[model samples]
Structures are given as structure tokens and as C-alpha cells.
Target: MDANEDLSPRVMDANEDLSPRVGMEFDTLKDAWEFWLKFGRQMGFDARKHYINKNMNDEKITSKGFVCAKQGIRGPEKENMIRTRNQDDTRTNCPVKLYVSLVREIGKFKVIDFIEEHNHTLHLSETIYMMRSQRKISKVHARLIELASSSRIKPKATHKLMSREACGRTNLGFVELDQYNYLRTKQQKNLIYGQAICLLGYFQEQLTTNPSFQYAVQLDNVK
Candidate 1:
């Protein structure tokens, strides 16, 4: 029950189908044990001090006090190279593996709470759609301005007089004409209108959980 002790046995029975190979070599139990001990020491886990001297008590994974080796299971790298590969594309394994990876990279306490908080709900598809749509709308707005300015054939006489006078005072009329020219482009106007509608929709979706309102539960508060 030592915290550092292999919890694989508790999690997996002797006759369990899943067999975890330590690394690239050593398929047998004795070899695997020796390799693990040696590797642990090399990676800075002292067997005599960690296991023997400390006389560490059984510490389950759920307990906040427990601490284990940062190195957890590696994916295909841990499998025996010589054995014919019977690769199982484990769907359940993905989240757990990600969780462990996050815990090791970040800290276990924060990650555990993050998982618990986000366990049941996280609208990934909706989030992605929102991001994509927002990008598309921004692109449309830029294109509209570019196209409108390009379509300007000639300037009005009044615009020329105003432009000359304004040039002495920082050319405000010329700048306004340039903007008007861009805004008059047919393609630009069309794109602007289209993007505006899309943006409205995205904002409507965001408004559901936008601080004051709540349509779905927010995961940010969990951590």
C-alpha cells in the first residue's frame, strides 16, 4: 500500500488482459522488476531510501497527501518491440493518459480538481465553431474594406476642392473619401453584411453564459 509501490496490481488483476511492459526491453517479470528498479534509481528514485528506510504507508491515489513518481506509462514506446503489435486504439485511455500528462507537467492537485470540475461537461464542438466563425467574420470585414477602395473610378469635384483645403489641415477630406471609396465596393458591402449577421449570432450564443446569464454550466469556476 506504499504510495510509490506499483498500484498496477490493485488496478489490474493477475489474470487481467492488460499487461504493461516497462520499456523497450525485458518482457519477463524478474527482468522487468530489475529494470524498473535500476531505471527508477537512474531517474532519481532510491529504492533503499524511498521504500525501505521511509517505510512508507499505503497511500491511495485519491488522497491529497499521496505523492508518486512523475513518470507514468508511455504509450506505444512501453510495448515490447519484438512482440507482434496488437494495438488497441483505446478511447478510454486517451482522457486518462491526458490527465496524467497534465498532472506531471503541471501539478497533480490542480489537474485532479480540473478533471473533476470538467468531467461531465465541456462543449468542445460549440467552442470550435465559435472560434472558426469569429475568424471568418474578421476576414470578411477586412476584405470588404479592401474591395470597396479598389472599385473607386473617379472622385467628385467637391471632393477634390475639400481634399486640397484639408491637406493643409491634415487631409481629413481625402481620408474620408478614401474610406467612402472602400465602403462603396459591392463585394466589400456584401461581405460586411454577411459577417455582421454571423457576428450577431456568435454574440447571441455568448450572451447565454456571459457573466450575467447562464445557459450551460461554466467549467472555469471548477478549478
Candidate 2:
């Protein structure tokens, strides 16, 4: 699939009601993000940080904001790549947003602006748990998944155990595919520079022994 494909079928727009009052203060970025997450759960939408600005002198935060996860249209840069996952064009240029900035004197972040209107349909309660921003594999669960794999337990069994502990599958707050995605990301990080250098060295040895041996590295358009 290309970036134009949307995994979720569109429904009617959500009744917008929950909103953050302008001038609300937060002690840290984490606090602000958690507040937004709570709002999303109640309002049937998701939020994501799209940009951040920092103070040059102290490297302190100056400004940042979260927008509807489906805030903007996909850019052309991703059009050439294989859409293995998460390339859905669900974004409708929704203007819903929450902007905040630092109050240097008091050293707290204050909400500067907000737009609660969303251009696209809000997620229904049943499916909201599946949204990227709402669901995540926490560190403790990730460790359990790793241990379960080591013990050769069937993945389905592990998932079932977790679901039962959480009271049911839906209450588990994540699915098997979500755990797989998290593991895939963790594996990528573990294979970073160390593996890259080893592979390049192997290729170089091949080139030295065989004159015609050749290799090339590929990167996406953005790189």
C-alpha cells in the first residue's frame, strides 16, 4: 500500500466537547502530554507532537505543541517507499491542536492556544484503543514478552495470559500486533551502528579477495 491508503473506514465526526483551558500550567513536558492523553481518551481522538522549539542559550524548551495525530496530509517524501505499515493517509489536515510555551520567569509551561475542532471523524470508543497514540507496549510488558519468547512459550498463550490478568483481551489495552511492533522497534535499535559496521567490514573483505565483488547501501528519499 502507498501513503494514500487508510486502514480505518471514515465515520461521522465526533461531538467535540473536552478541551484544555488556555493558560493551564504544567510542570514538565511529560505532565502536559499525560494531560492531553487523558483528554483524548474522553474525547475520542489522539494527539501527537509535531514540532518543538528550544531556547538557544540554556537549551531549555521555548515552545512546542501537539496536534491531532491525523493533522496533516502525507508528504511526497514517503510516497516512494514501501508502505509496510503506518503509511495511511488518515490525516485530513485536521486543525485540532494544543500549543504551549515556556514562562521563563516562573519556569513553568503554559498553554498558549488551542483548537478543538477536528476535520476528520473521531475514533469510536471500541477502536480507540488501537490508535497509535493511545496504545503502547510499556517497559514492564516488553520485558515479559522478551522472557516469554526465551522460554519458547507460544505467543498466543502469552497474550492470553496477559489478557486474563487485565480482566479481558480488550482491557489488556494492546494487541499482539502492537507487541510485535514494539519488539521490531527494539530490535532495530539493538542492531544499529554495531551491526552496520560489522556488515561493512565483511563487504570490504569480500571486495579485497574478489576484484569484481560490489555492494551498495540504500536509503529512503528523506535521507
The lDDT of each candidate is: 0.32, 0.77
Tens-digit lDDT string for candidate 1 (63-106): 12111122233456444442346752212221211111112233
- TM-score versus the correct structure, for each prediction: 0.15, 0.69
Expressed as tens digits, the lDDT of each residue in 19-39 for candidate 2 is 598998889888788778768
* All candidates: CA RMSD (Å): 25.5, 10.4
> What is the Å distance of residue 153 in model 2 from its true position?
2.2
Over all chains combined, what TM-score does candidate 1 have? Answer: 0.15
Runs of candidate 2 exceeding 4 Å displacement: 1-18, 76-88, 185-223
Worst 10 residues of 1 by lDDT: 93-102
